[model samples]
Structures are given as C-alpha cells and as structure tokens.
Target: MKSRSVIHVTGAMNMGGTERMLMTLLRMKPPWKSIFLTYGTGTGTFDQEIKDLDGEIRTIPNPGSLSDHFQLFRTVKPAAVHAHTLFQSGIPLAAARAAGVPIRIAHAHTTADPSDKKGRFIYEKLMRASIALSATDYRACSSAAGNYLFAGKSFEVMPNLFDPKQFKRPPEAEVLRLKLKYGWTDKLVLGSVGRLTKVKNHAFMLDMLSELHKQGIKAVLLVVGDGDQLKTLRRKAEELSVAELVTFTGAVEDPSIYYHLMDVFLMPSLFEGLGIAALEAQASLTPVLGSEALQPEADLGGGLLYKLPLEAGSAIWAEKAISVATDSHKGTSDPVAVPPEEVLKHYYQLYRWKGGGHEQKTADYII
Candidate 1:
C-alpha cells in the first residue's frame, strides 16, 4: 500500500520563524509523509535535514502560475496541501482545490508585510478572495496573524511551539568558555536572533548599545542569523562607534546554546506574527525585552517578557534591558512549554478533517 503524504507549500526551508515551526512539526513525526514545495530554486539550510528524515523537497517557479501548481498537485496527489506563503497562499490552494485535494489549509505567519509596494493592496485583496473561495481551512500562528489574513472569517490559532528538551541550559563550564571566547566576560550581554533585516530592526539594537555606553554600562550585543542586511548593519555599528562591542555570529544550525550566554534577549521588531525567539529565550531562562508590536501570545507565562515601544527610543529601552537582566529572580523559572504530543495532535486533527461548513467551531478541530 502507498503511504499517505501531505504537501507543504512555502517560500523556502530557510532559518526563519515559519520555517522553524514547520521543522518542529516535521520532527514530531506526523502520521503522513511530508513533502515540501518551495518557491526558491536552490538548496536551503533545512534541505539536507528533510532528506535525512525521508522527506522530499521540490521547487516551484517564483510567482508560480496556477497551472504549474495544479499540475504539481495532480502529479503528487497529496492528501492535503498546506500553504504557508501568507496572502499568496491562495495561488497554490486554488490549484489544490482544482486538483481535487480534500484538505487545503492557508496558514498566516506574519501580522503585516513591511515591504509592500505600489498596487500590493489590490493584489492582496484578490488573493484573499481566492483563499476564501478555495481553502478548506485557515490557520495562523497568532490571533494577530489570523485577524490580518482571515478577517471576517473564523480561523484556528496554532501557537508556535518548540521542544524544550532541545534548549536545556548549558553546563557552567561551557557557558564560561563561550563567554571567554566571545569576550563577553564581566559585560552585560544583550542578544537577538533573527535574520538581519530592516523589519527586525537590528539597527535599533545598535542604538540601544550606544545608549548603554553613554550610561556607563559595559554592554555587548550578540547578533545571530545571516541575511542581506549584514554589511549594512556592520557599517551602522561602526558609524555608531560601537563596532567593537557587537558580535555578529551569522547563521547557526542550533541557537539553543547561545541562549545560555545571554544576560537578556532583545526583540525590537517593527512587527511580528509571533516571536519564536522570545519563546526560546524564556524556555532557556533568559529575560526578553521585546517590541510592543509583537503578539502578546508570544509570552510563555514565564514572567520574563518585557514589552517596550519603538517610540520610547533607545534610552528607555536600554534602562529596561538593564533592569530586567540584573533582576536576580527574573527568568529563574521555567517557561510553560506545551508537550510535543499536544502540538502534534492539532496538526493530525487538521489533516484528518473532511471539510463541511464554516459554521463549525474551530475548537471542534483544534486544541
């Protein structure tokens, strides 16, 4: 008998929050075989790992035509097609509907797009209509994301979850060694993890570092993740005259160990669907100074999340970061982590669902 499979449509299996969440779901060993259809042509960071797990990765053309997607859907004949491409999800989902796939899911992963160009609004309106017409179910990582994409429509909010076991605190010796290696000894270490993009607002982190220095605080910023803005951010750090105080670690296969080296984790994003790094930081017992734009659900009830507005500027942010990091009791308790099985159950339920009417409660299908 042939194995049942699900097709996941995404941009690429890169190191981003959405991709990471998909990876977590894949690692949970869902009942169906997993196949990914990405828009980018070349290999991604997670390509090899997917192959190792007996999963397949195929590429569709950028701005893939509906016919292209329809053909692929027919060729694969997936049990379900789950699209994570936000507004553009409608394209593949419409194709899946045409291909007679029983289950089509449109997942929203971001609250808003910071790079909208002229006529983008009109495009989004059309795609959203298509999504409504074709998708059998809708999902989002946060309520904000759900509202942004599926307004006037009921959708399930599936919180992004990670395996806490992967983020165990490092041994004292290993922590000390990393601090020594990175010249982080006797300094307040501020860390941020995400692609170095304008939306992530890493330049704001440099400003915060500069402010800390003026306040006579010995501080260092550790930036993890690689992106197109790397050289620009490095230049900005130099222009701020805080070049020596910042360390850019580029991309890493695992950032769990780095959480142990941070005094406080920082996320000053302009906007976020849900900040997965904040959850990871809290899981590792590190306090977070996040942007007010982040979804409140990102907090794991660990009492470690401190929200600050971007309008508050760097000085206020610096003060809050220091206060949060130096508090002896803050971040001492373990965060509330959902069990892997619990998270997997929701995905399993969605995959097993046979769609009927939109009047059905989302709770009936998801936990």
Candidate 2:
C-alpha cells in the first residue's frame, strides 16, 4: 500500500510559535508523511530537522501567483493543504480547491497583526472571502485567533501540543553551568522567550528590570531568542542603564532547557493567538507573569500563571514579578496534566476526517 501525505504551507519554518507547533507535529511521526511548503526560496531553522525526519521541504515564490500555487498543487497532488500564513492562506487554499485537494485547511495562529496597513484592508477582505469559499475546515490555536480570522464562521480550536518531558528540570551540574555561563548566580533571574519583535513587548521587560533595580533588587533578565529588534532592545537597555542586568541569548533550539534557569518567566506581548512560551514555562514549573493582553486559555489551569495590564507600568509589573518569584509555594504546583498522545490524537482525527464517509479516509494528503 502506498503511504499518504500532507503539505503544510507556512512562512519560513523559523523558531516562531506556529513553526514550532508544526515541528512538534512532524516529530510525533503522525500516520501520514509531512511536507512543508515554505513561502520563499530560503532555509529555515527547522529545514534540516524536517529532512532528518523523512519530511520534504519545498518553496513557492513569495506571494506566489495563483497559477504558480495551482501548478504546484497539481504536481504534488497532496491529499490536503494546510495553510498557516493567515489571510495569505486564502490564495493557496483557493489553489488547493482548484487542484481538487480534499482536505483544505486554513489554520489561524494570531489574533492580530500590528503591521497591517490601511491599504491592506481590501486585500484582507478579498482573501477572507476566498478562504471562506475554498477551505473545507478551519482551525485555530485559540478562540480569539479563530474569531479574529474566521469571524462569523465556525472553527475548531486546536491546542498547540508540546512534549512536556522536554521541560523537566535539567541535572544540577547543567543548571549550574548555564547559571555560570550567563552570570546568573546570586541574581534574581527573570526570563522571557520569543523572537525579539515589537509585538512581543520585550522593551517593557527592560523597563521592569530597571524598576527592580530602582527598588534595590539584585534582579537580572535573560531574554532568549533572536529577531530584528535586538539592536533596538540593547540600546533601550543602555539608555535605561539596565544593560548590565539584561542578557539576550540568541535563538536556542531547545529553549525548554533554559526554563529551568529562570526564577520567573515574563510575557508582556501586545497580543497572542495563544502564548506557547507561557505554556512551556508553566510546564517547567516556572511561575509566569504575563500581560493581560494574553488570552486566558494560556493559563493551562496552572496556579503559577499571573496576569496584569500593561497600563499598570513596569513598576507594578516588577513588584508582581518579585512577589511571584519569592513565594515559597512557587514551583510546587504542577501544570495541568496533558497527555502527549491525547494531543497528537487531535491532529490524527483532524487529518482522518473528510466531511464524512470512509472513501475520503484513504486520501491522506496534508499541507
């Protein structure tokens, strides 16, 4: 019997949340083979890993013409096309419809885009219309993301699944090595993880560090991940005279290991479809202090998750951080138990569904 396959259309498979979720799916070795169709002709952080897992990676032009996508779909002949590029998903989904793919999915991963300009509104409207017409299924990481993208349309909320075992505390020697390497010994370590992008609100973390300094707290911040805002954030740290108290560790493949090094995890994102890092931190039993902008679903029933408004400013945020980190009960409560197989089963069920009937079950193509 021939094996079935699915194609996943997304931006560069970099270290972002969406990409990481896709990688998790691939690593799980689902029932079908996985193919990744990236938006441009460049490599991503996960490209090599995908290949090692017997998955394939192909590229289409950036904003590829409809005909280009249509032709690619025809050639690859996938059973499904799962598009993860937000409104841009409409184009490929339409092409998949034209190519007669059976399981066309539009997966929404964000609630908003700060960079969208007024002129792009028309484009979004048209693409959304196209998505409505073409997609056979709609899914999102959270209700907020689903409502934002599919508005009036019903969609499934697919939790971003991760291997909780990866988050277990590392050996004492390894923990000490990391602390020594980053000069974190004898300092209160507040950590944040994600790309150094504006929407992530990393600058607010710097302000919180500064506030902690003002209060005579020997606190230091460790920001993990890399992005365009690195230089800007470094400059902000210098301007605030908090440079010595902040350390920016560029992208790390296994950020879960670093979670053990933090006394408290901070997330001040302006918006999130679902905050995966916050979830990961909680999985590591690290208390999370997030902005109110994050969806409540991010809490994962963990007592360690705390939220406050960004309007309360860094002073209050710093105080909360200290309070949460210093509480003796911190790290005592485990995150809500989520069996990894149960999470993988959701994707398996989604992939196997085809609007009804066993006839479509054999046509296992995905994108």
Ten-residue region with minimum lDDT total, candidate 2: 353-362
Per-model TM-score versus the true fold = 0.93, 0.93
The stretch of ten residues in a row with the least summed lDDT in candidate 1 is 358-367
Residues 185-281, candidate 2: write the lDDT tens digits: 8899999887889999999999999998988999999999988899999999999999988888887767887889999999998999989888888
Candidate 2: lDDT over CA atoms? 0.85
- Looking at model 2, residue 5 earns an lDDT score of 79
| lDDT by candidate, in order shown | 0.85, 0.85
> Against the true structure, what is every candidate's RMSD?
3.7, 2.9
